[model samples]
Target: MVNGFMGRVLRAVGMAVRAVHVGGIMAGYALLFGAAEARRLLGPRRAGHGARAGGLHDGDRWVKMLTRLGPSYIKIGQLVSTRRDLLPPAVTGPLSRLTDAAPPPSRRRVRQAVLAAYAGTRWPFREFTWEPVACGSIATVHEAVTLDGRRVAVKVRRPGIQWVMERDFALTLAMMRALGAVPKLRKMPFKVMHEQVGSAILRQLDFPAEAAALAELRTNLAGLGNVRIPEPLADLCTPEVVVMEYIIGLRRFAPGDLDAGTRRQVVQAVLAAVYEMLFIDGVVHCDLHPGNLYFDERAGLVMLDAGFVIRLPDEVRRSFADFFIHMAMGDGWTCAQIVIESAAHVADDCDVAGFRAGLTELVQEASGAKSGQFALAPFAGRLFDLQRRFGLFPAPEFAFPLLSLLVIEGMIKDFDSAVDFQAEAVPVLRRRNMLRDRTAQLHK
Candidate 1:
């Protein structure tokens, strides 16, 4: 057995060496071809048939590339999609296509993972069907019945995921380092943003930690009837596996498959929950994509994947409240102040006047504009360019707002094409401010 294991290791090392040699040769040839292609197509060469066939800026190309590279690269695109502040709309906008879910591992692997997570459980596998109900890069989920016949969703981490993830991350980081050293990327925030996103993804892949976060969120949102978090089944829970209350019904509203009215309600509920998290609860589920949220038509809102929650400091939360108010009242000065404060860490050397001028212009322009009339896609693109064109304010943390702002606003517009963002938001801002004042009075 020892000799056989050693032989396998030696064989594996030989395979790795051969693979690297072939890969390097391929890469060199590809680079030569690519450089020649670029020189011919983009260089001083005559504007040839190349320009015609270049056709559309199909981001789906990148999506397919990531898929072929495997899970880590796929997640990198999703992470990139969120950072509109760091990337131009041209790059970040196309990342939205990266939401295709990962292929599921076999049901046998899922059961083994579950059993491994709960080391002492000799419980028969009969308790849960081996069929995977949902699957993704980090884990797959299966609906199960307990010995007592309780319906629950069993989430099991993919086999050997940790090692593969670690290897992929190391490779990605090395690639980022190389890319950062590139002349074009040296001035951009993509490298820093890449690291931050990698960190976020790492935290999310830790299933035990996610289970704990789920526990806290469920507790915090306990009394809210409109929002629901699945209760973790403690007895069946483990670092690599989590069991939660199964939500069976769905179909009210999601990005796809919703009437305007239903979509609007879903949008409102989602944003309001975000409001509650930032202001009232101080915690937010950061990954707010459609897959992370569901409309349980019979019950209400159901949020999944508690792994990527972000907790804001009190001062930050207050700034949020202030932004909301100023946005509502069209108060440029206050809005500018909040923008400065919110972004102080990023643009330390920024001309406050210029910063305020830019934000104020946007706020005023968007203030009373009818919803569908104003396209924020270009606005997002403009901001990305502003950062690149001007060395003014470079902060990595600012990426979240870049992500949240467009996401929330776009969701509103997507749901109610006729509903102006400023119009809908102003009323909520007024009510929240009023509530704040009354509550403050009671406290005093």
Candidate 2:
């Protein structure tokens, strides 16, 4: 093993090589695809030559490119997909299809991690299947049976993942620093957002924190009869591995498979749980993608992966909830003020009136002609664009939860559910405000 400055130098060099390799792959695809599109546009308009014939989408080539680069690249693609505010639907839509699940570690590595956690080769679990049920960048989860005959899922962090993740993030930060010098990119909140996201991903490498988050979320959501969080086996959990009650279910929602009543129950349950997290709990499971959320007709929704939870300060929570409430009510000026207050950086000469006027027009336009027609994702996307013009930058506290809400709203809409996000979330906001007011009066 390497140590001291020598190790740092080696790691930096390795990251540079990886970056060049990945960057080359990305640029190659861009050039090839750009040429194809140019040919199609400028050349003869052949009857058979269209987007479908060229590929599933123009972004399809990128999916293949990123996938070929390996797990870290795939994870990056998945992360970028959540940025609906940054990328257009055409770009992110294809990226969302990039799967996080990968091939499991070798049986020897899996058994060794479990043994290391248990402090010996002898394991407590009666049946520890070498085959993993799911595999991702940070960890792999396998199905196992405890000695007491309890069905549990054992999640083991991949060996050397910490080192890889550290190097990758270091490289990411360096790239961001390089990009900071660019005139156009300098205005974006890349540095702050990257710091927050990088920290969250690093925290996820620690399984004990994940177990704690899962338990706390279960306790917080206990009253919601429809939501389910798997019980973590505390005695068996370690920083390297976590054993929890196994939940076997299908991925994402399939409306045709379930009865109308069941579908409504499922949709309502998910929305209510999300609303409560945003407004009441003040902490949320920041990664709300479909893969982490499972559905069972009888068990309701099974939420997995607590590694990326975000805790909001009370003031931030209240301001965020109120912002949405005002947005729902079509009070864009108030929302603008709330955003300005939450901004990490605001220009002295920023035009508050111009922002308010533009945002009001956007809100009214997105408010829809009637109920059930408005969308929160598009509205939030416009706000992201507004930040560029107004010199108001997002703090991590605000950006993370806002992105979480946007992702959840997109999931709800994907199922063609007519649930009104503002209408549903308004009650949560009102209730939270009422409780706050009551507590304040009591304190006085």
Candidate number of the best lDDT: 2
Candidate 1 accuracy as TM-score: 0.73
Please give the RMSD of candidate 2 to the true structure. Answer: 3.3
Q: How much is the lDDT of residue 432 in candidate 1?
A: 63
lDDT tens per residue, model 2, 277-313: 8889977997777557877656478888887888888
Clashing pairs in 1: none
Instruction: List the global CA lDDT of all models.
Output: 0.63, 0.76
At residue 273, what lDDT does model 2 achieve?
A: 90
Off by over 4 Å in 1: 1-63, 76-100, 124-126, 171-195, 221-224, 252-260, 342-349, 374-377, 387-395, 405-412, 427-444
Model 2, residue 384: distance off in Å is 1.5
Output the TM-score of candidate 2.
0.88
Q: Each model's TM-score?
A: 0.73, 0.88
Among these predicted structures, which one has the highest TM-score?
2
